[model samples]
Target: MPATILIVDDNELNLRLATRVLEKDGYQTTTALNGFEALELCDQNPPDLAILDVMMPDMDGYELCRRMRENPKLKHTPIIILTALSSVDDRLQAFDVGADDFLSKPFVPAELLARVKVFLRHLEVRAVGNENQMARKIAVFSLRGGVGVSTLATNLAAGMSQLWGDETALVDMAFFNGQSALMFDLPMRNTWGDLAQIPEEEIDAEVLNQVMLRHSSGTRVLAAPRSAVNADQISEEKVSHVFELLQEQYPYIIYDLPHDFSATTLVALDSADKILLLIAPELASVRAAGMALTVFEELGYPDEKVELVLNWNFQSQGLPRGEIEAALKRKLSIVIPYVADSIVTAITMGKPPILSMPETPLGALFEDLAFRWSAPEQKKKRPESPTDAWRRIAERMRKRAKAASS
Candidate 1:
């Protein structure tokens, strides 16, 4: 679908130029001479996007942005400031006034079109979340093997999907040894390994879904490969491709990562909206989790992106809350009380505790945590592998050259 864009500027020439450029690029644009007119037009007929010039008579871009944010009708609309101000402070002020993006007056037309495309892509991704924030990406992973990583991931995704009345997908990036399929009694038929045979150029959401199998409860599983050789073929490039495709198609993309680090794992981690590092209340789990935290920190993962999850599934080796805090020297974000016997039985029976037994203590835990982690977030990083890095650098140089010419 074509996005409806509103171009608001005091100067008629600027408006005409922007409108012509956007229309030429296959966008539907509506023009307003000033902020007052734009506001009235928006209240009457809302647009999917708006580009406002900073300097205007009666109302400036900053005030216009503030007013747009205040209006419920235009609250979620993407606003780009096309202005002559290029200073850091001016950009910060624009952001403070609720601008989604900013553009300088003398910008290249290609950059303008690229920025507009970015806004449109972003708008499409966020349209669903604008009404319901709970159906967003949530990643559950761990450093140690048996801290209930898959258990938490399976149940949490099932619980969330049920609560939202939407489908949730559990992605088993644990490669060969992943238990996500086993947890749901799903087979490895046409696993992520199948994607390796498909040409990367033709891989889209529809092709990706062919490899995924649906559970009886509307939960989907992208099970890992059964063979190590096949898993080896599923490289970082494939993982990055999957994340991009999934975010646009699925409401949630939960990854059950392998116990150790891999290039593909890092790409998945970087693309995650939230990370749930499952840790047991023991010294071993704490130490392992600390090492994992160091890795994430070294890669510049924000503290807010990771939440240390204490999975207290046993009594003997259990450590107190203070003991955990003292061991890791960090406050825990969430802790699940030990729901020992029944939850294990459900998993053994190849059923998610959240769906099979929603009234159980473990199911309730998943539900409460799902509600708490419903806010939208994104990570800012380039590709993970060295080859991807080289490709990105080349792409950047090419773009710079193109911009210089333009």
Candidate 2:
């Protein structure tokens, strides 16, 4: 069935124009000349998405949006605010009132269509997985330190959240000295320490939600404790329970693991849907990765469950890719090139490359990698309307395949 969109504008011509543009694309559109009529229409039948003009009689777009968000039936509906006001303050006010996107008045029809398509595509992707679907847990681990394990985990989590616009969890399992919160510039308001005192069976969704820190990129972080003593109080049982609860809440979870097979680390590794074993180009990193692989094999993990990721952390005196692959006896699924300056700057600014510099080579690489690790069901089926991020990744893949063929 074609998705329905509700267009609300006081101007008759503006309403007709928006309606015509949407209907031309096969979307069923209902028009309203005022906020009261829009609410009445919505009460009768809710739309999959809504386009609202900010300048309306009696009730402006901001109030209309707030009322819709308050309505149980319209709370999750995607809203795009259209207005002549193009100031940053106006855009921020629109967002504050729960608008998903903003467009200027006299907007290009193509731009409107593009934005609508993206929202609908996201809705379709979300609908594909119901409540029964468990989160895809990805654990980034390295037996050796300083191999950019935490860096990769942060980028992957942030990238996935940005791509899907869904809440992705980033669990800092490096409880002793995890920097996941710092990477995103989140304050350590609540952490695993908050959950440590609670009995494992007593920990529930509401409690977990309080402990998780929200990021602008839609990534919620389970930050490590500030004190080592608090970290030590977190037991393996608590970690297991937290993972089980997180799987129910988030569609994706990224684990930034410590450099040992500790009880807490094992709990995360054992629960992971996919394990990314990160290694640098040096011999020790390769040896450490090999040992980790052996342990995974011993633990009965399937070959496909664990993937090798080669990080070129150093600019010089690094082993070749072939040598590292030979030493580890596994093909590298992803290779992150050396971008020390970029990485350092991103860290210092409390931003991940994927969020701050998405157009840069490093940012694009992480974003693409995050998409590759998305939920299998989401990747297996193409969306009815592809999002811009999806199209960009698909185009990149096509170009790469073509180059290889030629």
Candidate 3:
């Protein structure tokens, strides 16, 4: 379908000429005689994109652009300032009013259409993975290594996608060991760097579509760079923006986070409407998890947000879930039994268990867990303070370090 473009101009000739040019290019054009009319039309029914002439009789383009942005309906519509006043100051003011692009007067019709088409194409990409309103969310996390963190995360995300009409995202926040591309035999190079460089002011869903990875399982993956310390760029502030965009964009945003606490971790904690705390039923890791819970509690994070999963496919040491929970003084939210050969075979084949053997007991367990986590919430009474959370988290880190040394 042709994307709609709202044209706002005082001069009827310009409106006629521009609308004709864009309409001929297969755009659904809506013409507004002046800024007031444009605002009214936009307020009544929003457009996908807009074109505004800067100099109008009653309301100029700058003020009109500001007005359009003030309305939530018009905020995401890419605004084009088609104006005769070509001065730098005027262009700056146009941008100040939130113009996406500017087209000077006497502009080639092709140029006008070309820029519009570019924005429209990007706009389409921006809309990727944004279709689902009801879907399950799962967080893959760990405090210890080699406990199948990536394997669990990848397969769980892929498994849940099938449950949600094949719409999901597998995000790798481990900048150095990012294996999303390698997991499914996808390419090594991507636009993750491009996304990091994008200023917050210019960021939107459309821009993210151009950067995120899309797996064949219908799951979109956003992986971090394997070499660069790009982790810092993906901070809690920026990560919050990215996750919010992804949560809306994809049915499920699979977070592949690091074992340690950092800005990204805080973002993960905040972003997780639900967090799957993956832990090995070992003495060391379980103790570390206990400390992590204390840190989360001090931070004011609610216990309801976290679902603990004990990966007991390996050696259980005959310890019960109650024993672990009692040691930590918290409840065991969820548990995933060790699936010996199934776990190994899934990772060896470079695929998640859902795809490796969708019929297996292992895959079936994850499917149920996915649904269990997806259940709608009642109300969670939780508060997280920034400074105190950090201090307590630091104390937890010290304990973990002491345990490691001992």
The estimated TM-scores of all candidates read 0.59, 0.69, 0.59
TM-score of 2: 0.69
Candidate 3 lDDT over residue span 71-93, tens digit each: 97776577888877898787677
lDDT of 2 by residue, 1-406 (tens): 7899999999999988999999999999998988999999998999989999998889999999999988989866878899999997997788788786788989999989877875676455445654757899999999999999999999999988777767789999999999999998766657998898788888997678767876657788999998898888998888888998888878899999999999999999999999999999998999999999999999999999999999999999899999888877779998999999999999998899988998889988998999899988888777777756677777888899999999
lDDT of each: 0.76, 0.88, 0.70
lDDT value, residue 128 of candidate 1? 40
* Ten-residue stretch with the least lDDT total in model 2: 121-130
- Clashing residue pairs in candidate 2 are none
Candidate 2 positional error at 14, Å = 26
Q: What is the lDDT, from 0 to 100, of the residue 57 in candidate 1?
A: 94
In model 2, the runs with Cα more than 4 Å from the true position are: 1-130, 384-387
Among these predictions, the greatest lDDT belongs to: 2
- Report each candidate's C-alpha RMSD, comma-separated, in the order given: 20.3, 7.3, 17.3
Candidate 1: list runs displaced more than 4 Å: 1-135, 376-406
